[model samples]
Target: MKRINEQKGFTLTEILIVLVVAGILLSLILPNVLQAIERGNVTAHQSNLNTINVALFMCYTQERDWTQCADITDLTDGNFLEEVPENPFGGGYDIEDSPDVAAGDINAGKVACSTVEVTVGGDTLPGTCSGA
Candidate 1:
């Protein structure tokens, strides 16, 4: 009687097929991962803005006035916040004075007294009041 040997491992074709499937799966997942990271950055910017707003409100309550704190440096100097929050996209905060608008104006809704307009990546999130 003669004995025959059986296959012990995967063939080369099977290994190549597995590699191709893995590559396809990675291609589908990579973009979504990158997009999530970008969105996380945006969320961080928004959270920073909200923190500044709270600090400004606290300052206003103590000072009893709606006045800009000289600048971002002043906010840090007065200990409202540990330091000025930087825009996640890039650059520092874009400080702007509010225009004189009546109690009810279309633009008024987008403007806050003594506001600090934070421009991230050239896109402005309006009505961020730093003093009021």
Candidate 2:
């Protein structure tokens, strides 16, 4: 049989050292990766808001009434949006249409996320969208 020094496997000390190095590297890198992902999600959320506003605008141009496109299907029927995007946090978009023109909120269609307050990077994004 070969001598113990001739064996071709790592020693316990060497394996422990490797594990320690890997743990240190992950500790340094994991937070940055997670932050980048959160930033991307926030960015996507903002884009979705813009898209909803644009779709509402298109629907209003067709229906001539902001309240007419109260539902996502209403906008989809007019090809305003191909498909509704899923909110990154959770739930779908909330579309609110103002029908009462006399209330001083005429033709104001707003789209917002279910999660009312979305805070990213310690700043709040515009949580609602309007046709105008």
The whole-model lDDT of each prediction reads 0.68, 0.70
- The most accurate candidate by lDDT is 2
lDDT of 2 by residue, 56-119 (tens): 8798798877567778788777899999876786767767433323322444433322223344
Residue-pair clashes per candidate: 0, 0
How far is each candidate from the true structure, as Cα RMSD in Å? 6.3, 6.2
lDDT of 1 by residue, 24-117 (tens): 9999999999999899988988898787777766665676544545355656777888988867788876444456543243224443454455
Model 2 lowest lDDT segment of ten: 109-118
Top-TM-score structure, candidate number: 2
TM-score of each: 0.64, 0.72
Cα error, residue 115 of model 1, in Å, equals: 6.1
Cα shift from native, residue 9, model 1 (Å): 11
